[model samples]
Target chain A: MSTPLLYALTGAVLWGIGLMGLIGLRHLLRKLLALNLIGSATFLILVGLAQHHNGPDPVPQALVLTGIVVSIAATALGVVLIRRYFHLTGRTELESEVPEAGRDEEGHSG
Target chain B: MSNWLMAGLLFTPLALATVSLLLGFRQGRALSWLGMLLQLLVSVGLWWLVRHEGGFYYTLAGWDAPLGIELRVDGLVVTFLLLTTLVASGCGIHAGFYLEPDRPWQRYFWPLYWFLWAGLNTVWMGGDLFNLYVGLELITLSAVGLVALGGQAEALRAALRYLLAALLGSLAYLLGVALVYGQFGTLSLADVAGQVRVSEHALLMRPALVLMLVGLALKTALFPLHGWLPPAHGIAKSPVSALLSALVVKASFYIAARVWLEAGVAVASQWMAQLLGVLGAVAIIWGSWLALCQPRLKQVVAYSSVAQIGYLFLLFPLTFGVEASVSLHAQQGITLQVISHALAKAAMFLAAGNLILAVGSNRVEALAGVSHFLPFSLFSFGLAGVSLMGLPPSGGFAAKWMLLQASMASGQWWWIMVLAGGGLLSAAYVFRIYKASFLERDEQDHFYHPDRRLEVAAMLLALASLGVGVSGSQVLSVMAMPFEEVQ
Candidate 1:
């Protein structure tokens, strides 16, 4: 197999692992890291597969660059919100993740 | 003139976003009025231009497709642009008075609101797959900002969940874009569609399409993937909730429908189409049932949104592998459903906000005797609910009528049951609200009164939802205009 194809396959494997981590992890910070991992895997598959077929295409490379900027912005926003949530509630996990906090489903902070 | 109109349409919200960020709430409110008026005029001009001149492609910075981004100024796209201007301006007007301008964070609302508007316009006009991804991200992040604006614990928690869900969806969609580019070596949706139309191994692209659809579905809050939507929608400030429910979710669904329509004939199987329809059917029944059970008023409305969104997915089954006329009918029905739902839901949320403001509580039981004190807002809520329940002389009814015809034409008798059952189930939930408000209670006499302007904003949207039923044919004609290429 070509080098690019091998990279794409590795990306596919990483994507599965990242998705599982995202779903399985309860901590918000760990979830954010898993999301970043998924974003990296997607960028890998994007550039790897495009260059594998077309012999070094710039379009997918450009797309990957834009994707990186967007994911960073998203991650930054997530961190800010998670930090604020932690400060206010003093909990590092989602309410749904805790069995005791399930009764507050309809509770509004206001 | 048309080029200038396009520039104004695209540039106004972005400029407003930047300018609003530097201004205080009062100054921002004054400036946004002018900006909204300019946007409204530009949207009308673009709609008129597209109707007379037909659709054309607007390349950004003189770069053609396959190398640079292109904006598709099509009939359907311009229609959505006008719809966005109307619904967004309505929400903005309500936000001006609804938000307490004295709060420090309230200043941030205008900037985020304008950014969300710009992002929505981008999604409607975006012709390139990667550009659409960026636009979707822009919308998602700004929407998260809006949801978390109050900085309350529940609001922050809801915002985090929404952000995480939206990010996962975006990554899935990006993966699909990567796969499609690898398969076809193009990022422009039009170019990809053209190639898929003639490609011998079109089935090879099915995986990419499925990934994109699934991602868009999650963002759109389709059933089974909708766990993150209610809290986010219910916990946000009223105007923010109106904007999120009215337009944000529809943005993702719009891209999915565009992608499916352009290439599903070549790559989709009958089994896949039927599977989507079945899921939609379940969403209608299950979502409505849940909506009926919710104790909070906004939760009920949010869950109803889930059910209403299900009606849009019938487009997949009705169009796929069907005749040309059947597909066209389904498309028109779905478009009408989208337009009407946006108007009605915005009106409902705004009116519900007024009711909550008056009663000083979010629970449905607190609405007892609300009709006595706040008859106008309550009336507006009921009027919007009329459209939601698909009653006569409403746009929702017109949309369902068209869908009924399409299902019959396509010989999909199974979907007929879903359409009828969903409508009745919606009526059950809507009336539950009506019933709660109508209960006469003498003990709850103390109530707060909202400004008259908030009621007017909501009433106008509710009227539009009702009036669109009569004008449905004209809107469909605009959507039917032929495309003309321009250099």
Candidate 2:
């Protein structure tokens, strides 16, 4: 098997794992990490797939660079929002994740 | 002169965003007024140029396509550009008076607003797939910032959900772009379309098209995936909600439609189009039903947006596999729907804001005695509602009329029923608001009158929505102009 094809297959597998984590995780922080993993997987596949066919390419590499910067910005913004939410509500999980009794306390606090 | 106009169209919002960040809110307001006037002129100038001179590609920084970024200044794109200028300026003018001037956090609003505007223009003209992805992120970040500006608990929660959903959607789209580049060895959408037309192995790229469409559909908040939209749109300040519902969501949908129209015919299956159409129909019915149940005024408006967006997805089924004339009618219909919905929705949100301001509460029950004190804003809301309900002499009616024609011509009678049912459901919710306001409550009059400018801002948008119905033919004529290929 070609080396680039192997890399692209790895990316596809990682993308599946990241999707599962993002969907199954309840904690917002974990969810953010899962999103980051997905980002890495997408970038990997982009570079791998482009290079697998042709010998070398600069365009996909450039796209991956931009994608990384965008993901970083998104993560930073997510952290800020999550921190503020935690400070206000004193909880890390979303409202739907909490049970009935916890929601009552939340209603009172809010 | 035209080159300068294009440059101005691209430069003004970004420059003003930077300048606005440095100044105070009031100072930013003053500067933004001048900036908006310049934008309006530039947008209109470009629209006129594209109409008369034909559409052409503008290679950014002298770099050609498939290698560097290019801006596609076509009939449909310039039409959206003009629509953005009109709707965004209305919201901007309303925000100036509506936001509390003394609050320190309010200063951030202008910068975010302009950045969102810049992002929107980029998406409209972006010819390269990667550039559109960047544009989508720019819009998502700035919009999330706007929603979370005050940083209250509920606002933060809504903003977080919005951020997550938007990020996920963008990544899905980027994944598709990666596959397309791998297959075609080019990131330019035009180049990919050209190749897909001639290539025998085009079926290999069908998964890529589906990924992109699903991503954009999620971003557009099409049904079942629309969970994140209401909380974010409802919780944001009125002007922010206006911008979000009217423009931000449409940006993603515009890209999706462009992709589908350009290359979908070659690679897409019939079931995919039908499935999209089914989802759109369900969104219309379910979203309107949910809108009717919301207790808060703005939530109803927000949910209404979800329903209206469903109308846009109908473009997919109506156009795919249809005759050329049928598809043309469907395209014209959807374009009118987008423009009219933007104007009417903006008007409704601004008017609802004024109503909430007058009553000092967001609940529908609290609006019991509002009609007596604030007939003007209520009337504006109702006028916008008329358009939403697809009533006569409104832009929404004109759009639905063409859609009905296209569906009939295509022998797809089922979508016709969906269209009619969606309109009736919308009327039910719109009237619910009216009913609540008309109930008499015996209490001392404690209403606060909003600024005259806010009322005027909303009233103007409402009037424009009605006017678009009369001028629908002229707009369609412009959209029919031929494209001049890249040199």
Instruction: Please identify model 1 stretches exceeding 4 Å from their true place.
Output: A97-110, B485-487
What are the lDDT figures for the candidates, one per model?
0.89, 0.90
- Tens digits of per-residue lDDT, candidate 2, B176-234, equal 98889888888888889999999998644898899899889989999878888988898
Against the true structure, whose DockQ is highest?
Answer: 1
lDDT of candidate 1 over B135-195, digit per residue (tens):
9999999999999997688878888888888898988998999888888888888889989
Model 1 misses residue A65 by how many Å? 1.2
The local lDDT score (0 to 100) that residue B70 gets in candidate 2 is: 84
Tens-digit per-residue lDDT, A6-103, candidate 2: 87789889988887887778788988998899899999989998885548788888888889999999999999999999998898876643221112
Models 1 onward score TM values of 0.97, 0.97
True contacts kept of each: 0.74, 0.62
